[model samples]
Target: MSDLYIGLMSGTSLDGVDGVLVDFSSVQPRVLSHATQGFDDRFRAELLQLNTSGPDELHRAALAANELARVYALVVKRLLETTGTQPAQVRAVGAHGQTVRHRPQQFDGTGYTLQLNQPGLLAELCGMDVVADFRSRDVAAGGQGAPLVPPFHQALFGQLPGVTAVLNIGGISNLSLLNASGAGSLIGFDCGPGNALMDAWSQTHTRQAFDAEGRWAAAGTVHAGLLQSLLSEPFLALPAPKSTGRDLFNGPWLQAHLQSFAHVSAQDVQATLTELTAQACADSLLKQAPDCKRLIVCGGGALNTHLMSRLRALLPGCDVASSAVHGLPPLQVEATAFAWLARQCLERQTGSVQSVTGARGARILGAIYPA
Candidate 1:
């Protein structure tokens, strides 16, 4: 029997899915292989539209969920083919379906989050046991069903003495701090905007999906006015146990911040947004985990060269680097995390800590769909 689990992650950016075949046969699990599968243009647009109020809500979301499963099935096929592994040999798949809405605080009750996925479809399509819906349980338990990767960071970086922080710069930025083998204070929360605002601006101006290595931002100067205004967002001051997404920091939100600075150039806005992300992350790390020695960045934002420079500039004396510096590629860490989460669920282990998500307590996350 192969103790293998595949993790499929499509982050808040509405980006493609990242699939990783993970082997937990040893003390430290290993990513046997990693592959990325893209969503078609229609599906991407559909998901983006679903982010806000739209027509035909029930029908559209259901269609999008089914489509998400189809795309995920493609990822599974690619992962198994590339690794020469059979679906039957794999244990389970941890599918963090695309998160459309992550509102952990609702007026009526604790709160809720929704990830567009069809695990039953995935299990049927991929011929493997599927584990997904990893966030709802934490929310049901009165926790912000966000920043689910911190424990994985703790497990991965736990043995490295001193305070170690893992910053995942996806659509939104989140910080996961671990003090070496659970030795000290652990903190995890969404820092602020990562690529979402920047990408939206880039797409609007350049017609490109992203700002390729943060080149545009590097070419521009950070407008202090805009940066200050952006920094003034209330989410930043709320302290830990808080999380946010594009719902609050999208393009319109950025535009609202920029309205006062009409003369600011587009590139400058990009630069300021980039600064916003770096500053929020750095400030949170310095304040929350003062003794943090090593900062490892993962997600698509880590690949942004200029963003890395900004982080290093803000965080002097802290060895700022990508997750690749440690071993796992920046893009693969989250997907691999889901794979580990699947293992946790199957073993009845708690995947989240109360301190991180403000959950009532640790609980096994994700729903299992038998093959």
Candidate 2:
């Protein structure tokens, strides 16, 4: 018996969607096929707009959702066509729609997070079961509704006989600590800005999407004063069960930090931002899981060469490397996670454990829309 699922992820970067066709036939799941589809500049702009305030947002967002589904369907079509798989053969598709807003910390009773998606529309378009909205249930249960990948990380990398921490550095960074000692529960939390600040700065000055290989950052010296001020942000000191997105660390936020360092060159600001991500991650590990010497780094940041060097330098004696060294590439890890999540939902299994997200207990996450 073979259980196949396709995972679609539109991460906080808003650059594109990653789709993977996975086969769960043996103990170790196999990647049958995978592909990426970048959003057109116009579509990307609209998505960025929805991330913040805009007029006629209701109508614009609806149109964007439809376009998103259409684009996702294209990715799915390619994944299946290339792999010779079919929607009927696959059990489901796990789609993580773009997160326009995430404010799980607002416990004043009016807090809500939004990931723009039309799962039902997706199901209809793909003719396959779709599992989406994996965050809300955790929020409803008094959890941060993020870093949801920790449980999935546990499933993938937990067997290693030590404190194995998987670091995901997407738009924001998060740590998933798999303690093979003591209770053996997985601990997860956001570590703060990952590539967001650097990416924004790079786009502003170089007109590049991101600082490829961290070259620009490496060319400049770190502005210690600016780095210190950025490090002072209170969110970095918060306890676990926290999550953040562009909502907190957007362009305006970075501009405010840069306003204080008027004389610093753009490259220095970029370098400092890179240092900020590395330092923040190191701080989290040293503070929480000092024994975690083995880290599996993933997401867009892992590909940044200089950032990897910074991480290795800041955290002495720790073995730092991309997820590729551990059976999955940096980009494939998250999309594959949702594929596992979809399979879990189908089996009525608990998708997340309490320790990871501060939920009440292990609960089945996400809603299923049948084709």
Candidate 3:
């Protein structure tokens, strides 16, 4: 009686689309198959531009959403093929569409978060029910409408006796501190830049998408003064139960901080960005979960060797390791969490934690589409 769900995620990184097939019957959802499809450079550029452009940007967003829907359909088809699961056998697909504009609070007092996913079109194309629009409900409930993975973390890895910090380093980084009582109490927030700064710096310098295992960063020295300046960002000091995305950690932010550092070596900047992520993450964890001895790292940043080494240096007493060490692959954890959220949607269960998202109370997240 296991249900198969396809969870599609396009994160803050705007790198690509990750579609995961998961089986939800037991405590831990089983990942059946996964596929990642990279977005074309043209689409990426358009997306980046739309993030800051004016009302005319809506046209670009529409184009991007159409393109993304096609990619989602393709990924769903490939996932079904790879898993040997027919479309009829699958319950539904959870589509976390591309987040174009997430203005949780507007100057006009209208709070809205936009995740540009044409779920109806996706459902029509994929021939399956699509659950999307997951963030609006939480915002309506007076929540931050982000860092929605903590409840999933609790479901997947909350067995330890003491506080455990689950750090997810996607384009943005967020941490969830799970109290040891096994009562599912948690606190979470976006720590500052993760791979976003490093990736932007690398691309600006070497035309590379990323540092690749943080090799380029490992070759350089961390600029301590620059790192401190980066750390001084107001967002880093923001209290918990908060969240952020590329809106805060994009190229312009980096450039503003660059100042005279434009003369610095690209490698040095890369190293400093790496250190920034590690330090910001560790600082957040230490402040919130001072007694936490176990830090579980997940997402793309977990694979960055240089970043991991820096994190290990910053948190000397904590046992820092990838979620893979605890049975979850770094790259697939977020996708899998979305799959779990899909399961929650199906069961009419709450997928968000009030303690994490500042929601008034727990509520079932996402709008469902019948197959």
Report the lDDT tens digits of candidate 2 across residue range 1-371. Answer: 45999999988887899999998887887898989999887898899889998999989998898889988999999999998886799999999898998987486753778988988888988999999998888888877788889988988888888889899999899999887445477889999999887887898899998999999999999999999999998999989778888988888887787788899998999999999999999999888888777989999999999999999998886899999999999999999999999899889998887787777777888899989
Choose 1 or 3, whichever is better by TM-score: 1
How well does candidate 2 score on lDDT at residue 19? 93
Off by over 4 Å in 3: 180-182
Candidate 3: global Cα-lDDT?
Answer: 0.85
Which candidate achieves the best lDDT against the true structure? 1
RMSD of each: 1.3, 1.2, 1.5
Better of 1 and 3 by lDDT: 1
lDDT value, residue 312 of candidate 1: 96
Assess each prediction's global lDDT (C-alpha) against the native. Answer: 0.90, 0.89, 0.85
Q: Model 2's lDDT to the true fold?
A: 0.89
- Model 1 whole-model lDDT (C-alpha atoms): 0.90
Residues 1-371, candidate 1: write the lDDT tens digits: 67899999999776799999999998777998888977676787888888888889879999889988998899899888888998889999999998878889777677778888899998999989999999999999999998999999888877787788999999999999886335865689999888998888898889888899999999999999888999999989888899988788886787787789999998988898899999999999888877677999999999999999999999897999999989889999999999999999999999998989999999899999999
Angstrom error at residue 278, model 1: 0.6
